[model samples]
Structures are given as structure tokens and as C-alpha cells.
Target chain A: MKRRRPFLLFTLLAFGYAFLYVPIISLIVYSFNVSRLVTVWGGFSTRWYGELLHNDQILSAAWLSLRIATMNATLSVILGTLAAITLVRFGKFRGRTLFSTMVSAPLVMPDVILGLASLLLFVTMEHLIGWPAGRGITTITLAHITFSAAFVTVVVQSRLSQFDISLEEAAMDLGARPWKVFLLITLPIIAPSLLAGWLLAFTLSLDDLVIASFVAGPGATTLPMVVYSSVRLGVSPQINALATLIVATVTLCILLAGWLMHRQETLRRRAPVIDIS
Target chain B: MTTRATINGSARNAGEWLGDLLTGHHGRRLVIALPYLWLLVFFMLPFVIVLKISLAEVLLGRPPYSPLWQYLEDSTVQIQLHLDNYRRLWEDPLYFIAYLKSLKIAGISTLVCLLLGYPMAYAIARTRDSLRNLLLMLVILPFWTSFLIRVYAWIGILKSNGLLNNLLLALGVIDHPLALLHTDFAVYLGIVYSYLPFMVLPLYATLSRMDLTLLEAAADLGCRPWKAFLRVTLPLSLPGIIAGCMLVFIPAVGEFVIPDLLGGPDSLMIGKVLWTEFFSNRDWPAASAVAVVMLVLLVVPLALFQRAQEKSEGKPPL
Candidate 1:
């Protein structure tokens, strides 16, 4: 009975994993399926991928999404890192609790509400400054930055809790200026966490549909927006192809990151042994 | 000696004090506080604006916002004034019903996730160390993909004449495709699939932390496996269950994408309604009101959940 129990557990675990990923698996498989219906099996072909490459609208939207994601991520990391350092290190003051809550509010706040608020902000800005006259890439990018930075702040702050301040103190004692210490020691130590936060922010900005849809004007159509409008009409194989590409790229990047981390750990262990020698 | 005396002047001490003020022990706090201020300006202030706008009357096609902004400039804007939007919300039964329906849907999906996630999490937790990491990785790998794409994949599966229907037809289960898409059932499935990982991680955290001897002790006391689970295991794991539910339910209530994509016309969740009011309808005032209400609904529960979590963590409930 105990032996049989292991087998049952294995089967259950396998089923659960399959349940989690089968839809995604099927989508990737069907992207290469020549058949139009996603359900049916057809001979393998890459025609959809070919079609995706040739589609101008899809390509442009993808470009726009990438651009916005990069900008949003960069801005988010800068702001978030600063905020994280302050909140975790400084700890308490007047309105500190309120400030912490405000920073994180965007993380849980409904996307629709965020979109409206951003739109309202834009309108108010337009009325006051007579700039950013309409919803465009700039507005969308700014909106993305708003929420993405908040998320990045949380990630960086959490990571900061694990950081040792002793290294910076040592650097300062060794005749480095405070800024120099931060740049050389603190930044390098926290770089991986910052990178992770940046990646998360980038992915979030790229994948945003609802907010982008709200703030996007004619020229600012992001990939998600394009995919959404297309999906609303009906399922298209092109979307399947696009999604497949994204999933593949993301999966590869994640695996690469993991491998790099593993290799770094291995090298670190080897370095200690070499030093002992 | 004279040069040294000049260099050690009081002005240098004053400058040092100013520099200390700028870069003190709390400098990091001041640096981090900048983002919080930005959030207060951009994120929290909008809610305040929403509250203010919700009070103003809708005149002609334009919203009554300018006057309210002016009223804010003056001392005449009574903070305690507006109950009309709240009153209207109460008078309209549909709004309340929509909130209830959303809660029910979110609740059921959260429950489903918990049921499915617990066993999976347990299996992963109990696995041999070598394989455990791989199993956990597999569980989290899907999360790296775009959530929207994952949800979109289900559309292909659930649509009439879709793969699931075709597979069933091929198996001679049914002659016709079932109306699976555009239904509350589909929305629930989507929610469960999306939120399952959230449920899994928390359960895994709690279960992994557990000492196996407690279960063994229950067994020694003549408790059966099921009884052991009910008595010892369940109580120990309630923290995880609560955490998982909060993680799933909080976001699920505000979910827009799944319902917007998979739900039918009748399945008008507040998220979709809110989206329309803000974007398509361009009724910012009404949209703000709805948003404010949603925020209120969420914040109260969120506070309660956090309080519970804090208590479990052995802290005074804030």
C-alpha cells in the first residue's frame, strides 16, 4: 500500500502540472498547426510565424510595446530603488506609514481605477500646462511608469532588507565618499535584485492591456492592445504565433537567468577554495 | 598654527551640520520617501479627486468638476457633504447585486484554487530534495509568461468548435459543441487557473515549515490519518489558507481581463462596468464614484485580512 501510494502521488502531481500548463502547451503546439481551428491536429508548419513576421501592424505594435517597456522599466528602477532605500533604512517619521501605503496602493488597486486616475491626471495636466494635449505614447508610458515604479519599489525594498550595511561602512572607512561607496559597493551588491525588479517592471508594462487600452490613442497601440482587439473579434492564429514567440522568449530568458545564477554560485564556491590554496 | 586655526573655524562646523542634515542616519529614509510622496501625489490624490468629483452634479454633457475644484480653492467645500453618490449606489439594487456576484465568483474560484493547490503543494513539499526543486520550478515557470496570453489560450480551448469540444465530439461524448465560452463557468475556470499559483506558494510555505513529528505524534495517539489532518495539520496550516485566500480573492474581485474576455453579456462584473464608464462612456465622475466605492469595499476587507495575518504572526493586530 505504501509503495502504491508513491505511484498515486506521482500521478496526481503530474496531472496537476499538466493542468497548470496544458492550455499553454496546446497553444504553442497549435501555433505550428496548419489547421485554422486551434483544437484539431494538423501537419506541422511554420506558416503562422511567417505571417506574423510580415504583418506590419503587429510588428509596429510590438516595437512600441518594447520601447515603452524599456523606458518604463528604467524609470521605475531608479525611482523604486531610491524609495526602497529610504523606507527600509529610515524606518519612521511623520506620515511614514501613509507614504508606505501610498507606494504600494498601485500594486493592488484595480487597473480600471488606475487607468481612470491616470487619465484624469493627464486631463488636469493638459488643462493646466497646455502640454500632453492628448493620449499618446508619452501619456501611456508615463502611466505605466506610475504603477511599474510602485511594484519595483516593493521588490527592491524587500531585497534591501536582506542587504548588509557593513560593506558600505567599510568602503566609507577606506576613504570612499558616500556616493562613491553606494555606487561601487551598495549598487553591485543589490544589482541582481534591481535587475529582477527592472525585468518585472518591463514585463508588466509590456503585458498591460487594460490600462494601455484606456490611455492609448491611435498611434500608441501596444502589442497587448493589438492582440486584445484581435482576440475580441475572434481567435486568430497570428495571435497564437505571437503568444508562442513571447512565451518562448520569456522561458528562454528565465532559464538563462537561472543558469547564470547557478554558474555564479559555483564560481563563488570555487573562488573560496582557490583562495584557501 | 595660524593657518590651522583659520581652517578650524566655526563656519566649517556650521557647514558640517548642514551636510549632516542632508546626509544623516535617516538619509536613506529621506531618499526612499521621495517615491512615497510621488505616489501620494499621483495615486492617493486621485482617489481624493474621485471622491470630490463623485459629489458634483452632472450638468449638460460636461461634468460638474470645475466648480468643485473652485469650491476646493475656497473653504466652502465641506468634506462631510457628499452622500448622494453613496445614496444612489444603495438605491440602485443592481450595484449591490453586482458586488455580491463578484464576491461569490471570486470566493468560489479561491476555494477551487485552494482545493487543487493544497495537494500539489503537499506533493512538492514531500518530494525528495533533488526532484523537489524541479517540481517547484515547473509550478512557477508558467507564471513567467504573460497572464493575458495564458487566459487567451483558454479561449481557444473553450470556444464552441474549439479543441475541447472537438475532442469530446471525437470521443462520441456529444454531437454538438457545448456553450462553454461566454459563461460564468468559463470566468470561474479562468480565475482558478490564473490564481492557482498564488494558492500553491502560500500553502507550500506553511506546509514546508511544518514539523512532520506532529503528524506522527497524532498517529501515536491513535488518531487516523484523516483525523490527524483535521486536528493537528489543519490548524497549523490555517495561516497558509488565509494567506492564499487573501492573495487570490483580493485580486480576483478586481479582475477585469478574465471576465471581459470569457464572460457573456449577462456576466457584467464591476470591473468591466468600471472600464466602460471611464473609457467608452467618458463619464469620469460616475466612474470615479464606482472606483471610490470599490476601493472602500476592498480596503476594509484588506485591513481585516492583514490584521488576521498579523495576529497569526504573533504581532498585535494593526
Candidate 2:
């Protein structure tokens, strides 16, 4: 208040954002640089991107990661939605406290604990039931869903708690069955949060390195595994390009999700009728 | 309607029965049980399995450890259990150092995050609505991207010949490239950089929702801005601060990627130790023991969190 300009605050804000964005921007810029050494910028070129496409290992790992992420996200949504529904719609169910603990526990559990435990689970299951054969994409997806679903449960639970129960009761009163009421009323209402949850789960699976590393076996190397091994050696231009592409895709998806959510909120404010559809 | 009546009445009866099975109390019960059952099998079972393995002795053969039970004739029973893993963990100085070191790093990084994040969160909270949304989006966008890649980005920037050093040299600020990468400082940087969003979001939520009138009232009472902030805003946002710190600290203690990527060989984190004990050392029992101990160590904080959540929700906690 004493000073006309809050220069210090502005500088801190700028520095914080710069600290956040500068590294990412640098990674993207160096991806375009036609040089073996990342420090030296030869010129702007798409040579690395071209090289990235030709790399078979990167391509296969990427496809594998995508398949796993999609499956993980879908399963997470199904399981987490059920958990959220149980908590919010079904009041005071048996084992409510235990259920809450289990649902929320994984949110803060370390990836190391999760990875080790799940790996042990898979190994023991294989010995007992001769199932899962050997760890690969299937094991990875299971490991991912275990944690991601907890996250989905949190997201969906928050949204569910805020929802007006009257709408669902109204539908039920109009001669709709419980399942029908849920399908016709609750599902549509929570679809945005569900989408957010799914996207969140997908991103989590895609980004995971430590857990996936532990669970994955032979011929099951994921994108992160590839990047991890490559990064351990050194930073290659190809990885930079791959990272830039990932950044672009993720930013686009997030912005789109934000826009969709904002639009839904605006529409809901304008007319409550539109929310039902 | 007449044509519908002509159809078999048993079909409608069956339909209702099926619908009842799908959407009735029993059906809802099934839906609730599905996730619970999954967690039981995957989450809870794993801990049990880890505990069991920790109790058993390591073996050379495939699948390693033998069954813990050995039943004999004449009503005699023997248990093939060993406390060697736990004993080893206690005997080894490395484990103690690693635990202490991890806590120190996690704590320091959490503090740095709070200092850095408070201003950013306040800036966003004080901004207009539209701009605030955009700024918040920017804060979260980094989170959407790969965390590993963000860590990797730090490697290039902090490398001796990388961008930061190059810029410093070109500006004549430093005649030589400093040894910035592969140090505890780099580990701190990586953790703080990556976990900043987690710190900012909760703080912003609390700060933005704070009633400005409280601060105004404090100012009217002859409180300076700093005093008003300490008296009013800080206390109000304490919950968020606690939450953000917990969120950052818990994961940081078990972080493997950041420390492994950015830290020097001297940086001994429990996560990395566990990884090596499992994979490199091939000591599954020891690794399981490490995990169990870590879980036990975390149980107190986690219970506190659950209590905090229950209090906020204003429910009778179980």
C-alpha cells in the first residue's frame, strides 16, 4: 500500500511462471534444433520429429501405452463411479467407513508400495492359479486402475455430493426404476465429471513410470519405460520431440476439457432445463 | 394398447423381475460390492502378501520363499519364520540414513513449495474472474503433461553446458559452467518444480474463497497489511496449507523418478533403495519389509488426514 507499484509481487509471479514454463519451452525449442548436442542450436528443423517416427521402439511403446491408458481409464471410471454412487446415493451402507478408507487410501499411497504390492500379487497369483501368465500390459493396466480409480472416486465424489438429489427422486417418482432413474438422470448429470475422471486416469496411466516399471515384463516396455531408459543414458533429440508432442496433446485436451466444463456451467446457469439433456 | 395386451403377460413379468434384479436394493448392493471386492483383492491383499513374504526366509529357487507352515505328525507343528529382514533393516545404518534423508528433503521441498506457491496462488486469487481461470488453467496444464518429461527438462536446463549455464556465461556473470546438475540442489529443484501445482491449487481454493471483509475489518482496526495478513488470511488458509503440504510431502518421500533422474549417486531415497533391493539386490523380503515399514510410518499421518476430512464434511466418523 505504501508503494505505487507492487514490483516485488509482480516479479515473483513472473519468476514463478517463468520457472514453470521456461524448461518446457526450452525442451520444445530444442526439439526443433538440428543438432546432436542440445546445447548448440544449428537451425530450426523437423529432423528430430522425422527421426522419431522412424524409431520402431518408440512407436510400439507409444501404441502399447495408449492401449493400456484407454483400458485403465475406462475401468477406473466404472469402478470409481460405482464407489462414488455408493457413497453419495446409498447413505450409510454397511462398511461405509472401511469403504471410505479403501477408496481414499490409494490417493496418497506411494507408487513404490503400490508397485511392489501389485507385483507380488501378480507373482503369487500366477503361482496359485496359473493366471496372468507373465506380467505385461495386463498387469500394468491392473496396477494403474488400482490407483487411478481412487482419484476418479475423489473427483466424482465431489461432484456427486454437490448434486441435487431431488432430480433423481423426481425421476423415480415418475415410475422409473432405480436403474432407469440412474441411467436417465444421474449418469447424464455426472457425465462431465466422469469425463474429467477418465481423462485424469488416462493421463495418470500414461505418465506413470515407477509403477509401470515394476509391473511390466518382457516385451511390455511402455513409453515411459522407453523414455526412462533413454533418459538414463542421456537426453536424445528424439525424446525431446516426443515430449513436445505429448505436451501439445495434453495441453489441447486440458483446454478442451476446461472449455467444455465452462460451457456446461454457463448453459446450466442460463437454463436448468438444459442440464437434464 | 390392445396389441400390447395381446402379447404374453409373462414377458412383462420377466422384464420386471430382471429390472428388479438390476436396479433393486440387491442390485445397488452388488454395485457397491464390486469396487469394494476389487480393492480387497488388489489393494488389501497385496499388503497381506507383502507381510507374509517379509516373514518368510529368502531362498535360491524359483518363487523364492517356502511356505511358512510345516505341520508334523504327533500333533507337532513348526513355523518356518524369520525376522532377519526386519533385523537387517534395523542393523543397517543405510536404512536409517535413507529414511532421515528422505524426510529432510521432502520437508525442505515442501517449505520451498509453500513459499513459492503462496504468492502465485494469491496473485491468481486477487485477479479478475476470467484471468484467474486462465491463470489457474496454466498452473494445472503442466500437471497434465508428463511429470517425467518435466523432470527431464530440468536436466537439460541445469546441465553444465545446458541453457542456464550458457545464458550465464554469455552474460559474463560466470566465467565457467557451475556443477548444478546431479546434486541435492537439483533434486530439490525437480521436486519443487514438479509438485508446485499440487501446492498452488489447494492454497488458491482457500485464499480465493476467503472473505475480503475480514481483511477490511482488520485494516479498519489499524492493522497493517502484513499484520492483517498474518491475523486474518494466514489462519484462514491454514487448512489448505496443511493439505497442500501433506499432498506434496507424502508422495515426495516415496518419489523414485525425480531423485533417480536429478539426484547424485549420494542421494539415497527409500524409494530408490526399495527398487534396488527388489530388482538389483533381488532381495524381495527386504523390499517387502521396507514397504511395510513405510506404510506403518505413514499410517499416523494418513489417519490424521482422514480425521481432517471427516471433520470438514461434518459427519460422524467411524
Candidate 3:
């Protein structure tokens, strides 16, 4: 019943945030260190960033990862939206239990299992059908899509469930076809969630390492793979630079998204109400 | 339904039938069928393949696992089910210890995350809307960054002569740099850090939706604030607690990166074991066996998580 914030809880929150951000802040700080050693601070410089830029392996891997992430994001949004529609709109179809489980299970399923199982599937498919020929970008993208779509589905499903069905019904009653109603009424309303889903899938695919490692064949390496190999030997300043870049990009994207959503919210609030009656 | 009837009654061409299928009841079926078939083939069927592979012998072939079925020279079919993979998993103390350690590590990390995250989530949930949004974003912002990178960041902090040690030395907290990285403690720190947001978001969802009036009633009934929280808020947040714990515990159990990066040689998590089996040993059957067993271990928690999700969503249990 106390409306005021508790001091202990607020302190805890501060500590929690500090715990979360300190490593990141430090990582960013060390990225500019001139010294090769990660722990010690030599003078501040951008040498690692320069080294990172010139590293052909990291660049090629980053390019490959970006391609996979883009394809995975686009494909996941489609699959996830359909899955969300099935769960939230279809209403108690046969195998709805299994369908729902399949849609969400990937979110919590271990990445190692997913990676291993998917690799096995591709191997079997290659042996049986002789299609896909061998694992590469295509296989990695497919594996990413499978799990990333689950994340997208969760995002879209929550939005779809909150949607007002009567809007679509009203459009339908006014002589619009089902698809037309969906396109004109439902799509616009859920577009924000779709965008969120797409971004989530994209980031997930980009960040994935274990699954990509499992499914990637010889010659196909992702950014995370390169980072993992380098980081394993010990922390490198170039990796610190790469991490700083990733953190900066992600932070920028999130802030932009937040601003866009806020603007949309304000515009919606300011819009005059339509009196159809 | 009427559309289907009308199409059946009047459709005399493939185009009409296709249109009906696209726009009518069958279209709904198609929407459901696409993702369903995709998951069935890619998600569910892989487990079946893993099970089959788990039953096969390790081989010196390209695939590295023997075929489950073979056609013999004579008029006979040979079915080889090598149960040794599973038997070896049970018999081997290395795997047994790894599984136990994985569960133990995941359990402790989940507990730690819950402890650290609950108050944070509650604070955010109880805040004004604008501040709440900003706070929640802060919590999730790190999550949006690369998970591997975030985990990698800890190495600099926890390693010998790392930031923490240097700071500690300067502060006279300890004379020697602590052996923090590549230890069980670092693994716990990494898991808890990475999974804290997962715990917080779900808890905040439940906590924010909680009715303050109930707390008010408890307060009016001569109850202390802490007691009111214990009796009312804690009980109400059980679903979130379960969901959050499951979310943290499930993947953490099979976490490969945290352990591989931060854990010492003694940290024998099943995920690391499975990875070594598949990649280092090139024993697909052993890896498949490990996966099958891990799935079995997680089946209960996974079900619990699904139920909690359905409950939170106000959906009927299947």
C-alpha cells in the first residue's frame, strides 16, 4: 500500500544496474587501450579499432554473419507471424497443443541440442536426398531461422493476442474480404510487433555461435565463431573494439526504436477520435 | 464456411479453387500448416533422428555413426541398435558427474539471479510509467548486445591481474590477485549476469499486473508491510517465479559458452561434454546419447515452464 519507493529496493536496483553495466563500460573503455594486454591500461588509443578494421578474417566473418542474420530475420518474421496467427487466431485447431509447444519450445531449448540436432537433420537430408549438398551459409541460416522464428513468434503472439478482433470483424462486415481485412486492419496494428520480432530474430542470428559452429561447414565462419576463437586464446584489444562496436550499434538501434515507438504513441494519443456512429 | 460451400458448388476451374483455398477456411488451415510442418520437420523430427543416432554404433565413416538399418548380402535386413552409447553414459562417471554438476551450477545460478533480479524487477514494476520504461530498457539493453561478448567481458574483470584484482589490490582488500576467472565462481557470475534480465522481465510482468488494493487491504488489516508482501505479493508472484527460474535454469543447464569460457578444467558441464564428444571425439552417437538424456532431464522443467506460460497468458491447459 505504500506508494513511495522503498530505499532498500532502490539501492538493490542501483546495484543490479551497476552489476549489469560495469562490465560493458569497462569493455568499451579497454577497447581504446594502446597496449596489447587487455587488463592493463596503457595510453588511450584507437589502434585496436584500426587492427579490427584490417583483420580480413573478422571482416569476412562479419559479412557472412550479416548476410545470414538478414536472411534469417526476414524469413523468421514470415514464419513467426504465421505461427502466431495459428496460435492466437485459429482457435483450438487439431494439434494446437503440439503446435503451441513447437512454437515456443525453441525459446528455452538448449542451443547445443538445437545445433546438434539440426546438424544431424542436415546430414541425414544430404545423405538421403542429396540436396543442400553440404553445410554452409544456407544450412546455418536455416538453423538460425528455426530458433529465431520461435523468438519472433513469442513477440508477435503476445501482440496478436492483445489485438481487438472486432476491428477485423468490422472491416469484414463493411464488405472487405478476409485477406483484405487482415491486410488493412490487422497488419498495420501489428506492424510494430513484426518489426520488433524481425529485430529480435536478427540480433539472435547475429549473436549465435554454438549453433553456427555446429552447422557451419569448412570455409563458412560467422563473426561469433571468429570472436570465440580469438577470445579463447585470451582477450584481445581488437575483440574489445569489436565488442564496443556491437554494443554501440545495438544501443543505437534500441534507442532509435524507443524514440520511434514513443513518437507513434504520442501521435496516437493526439489523434482525434473517429465517431463512426 | 459459406465461402467454402459456395466455392464447392460453383467452382469449375483450378483458379477458383485456388482462390477459395487462399481466402476461405482452407486459408486458415494453410497458415497453421506451414509453421506446423516446418517445426515438425526441423524441430521435432530432429529429436527422433537424435534418438536413432543415439542407438547406432560409432563408426569410422564420414558421418561418424553407423547406420541403424542395413541391407545384407543375403536376403535379410540387419537392424543394429547399439545401446552402448546410452549404457556408456550411465556407466561413465565423467558424464554422471557432468550432468550433476550442470544441474547444480544451473540451480545455484537460477537462485542467485532470482535473488538479485526480484528486487530490481519489483522496483521497476513499482515505478512511474516513464521511469519504469527507461529502467526496463536498461535491464534489457545489455541483453540485446552480444551474449558472447557480454560473457567475454567478465574475463577481463575476473581474470588474474584483471580489473577486479587490480582494484582489490589498490584497496588492500586482498594481497594476492584472486583466482576468479576459469572457476566455478566465474561460471556462476557469467550465468547469473547473462540470465538476470530473463528473470527480471517475467517477474516484472507479473509484479506490475498485481493489484495494489490487495496490499492496501492487508495493510488495513493490521499487517506490517513486509508481512503483507510475504503473504500477498510473494504468493501471487509464484507463477512468475516458476517461469523465471525455468527460463534461467533450462538453458543454463546446457550452457556451453559460459562454462567453456569461464570454467576451469574441473567444471564438467554436460554441454561442454557433449560438445567435446561431437567435435573433439567425433563421436556422434555419444553426443546424441548425451542430448537425449539431457532432454529427459529437462522434460519436467520444460513442461512446468509451458504450463506457467499458459497460466500467465490465461490460456486453457491442454
lDDT of 3 by residue, A1-277 (tens): 3476679999999999999999999999999998888888899899999999999999999999999999999999999999888877777877988887887689899999999999999999999999678999999999999999988888888888888788777776777666666666788788988999999999999999999999999989999999999999988899999999999999999999888888877886897342222
Cα lDDT tens digits for candidate 1, A1-277: 1212457666777878888889999889999999887667788999999999999999999999999999999989988887777667665668765666566556656788788777777766676797678888898888898889876876777567667787678777777656556666777667877887898899989999988887787678898888888888888888889989998898787777777767867885676431110
The lDDT of model 3 is 0.90
Native contacts present in each candidate (fraction): 0.49, 0.67, 0.75
Instruction: Flag regions of model 2 displaced more than 4 Å.
Output: A1-7, A274-277, B1-22, B73-77, B220-222, B312-318
TM-score of each: 0.85, 0.93, 0.95
TM-score of chain A of each: 0.91, 0.92, 0.96
Top model number, DockQ = 3
Q: lDDT values of the candidates?
A: 0.77, 0.87, 0.90
- Candidate 2 matches the true fold with a TM-score of 0.93
Structure candidate 3, residue pairs in collision:
none
On TM-score, the leading prediction is 3
The list of candidate 3 runs beyond 4 A from truth reads A272-277, B1-20, B73-75, B314-318
**Cα shift from native, residue B89, model 1 (Å):** 3.0
As for candidate 3, its interface RMSD to one decimal place is 2.6
Q: After superposition, how far is residue A59 of candidate 1 from its true place, in Å?
A: 1.3
CA shift of A104, model 3, Å? 1.6
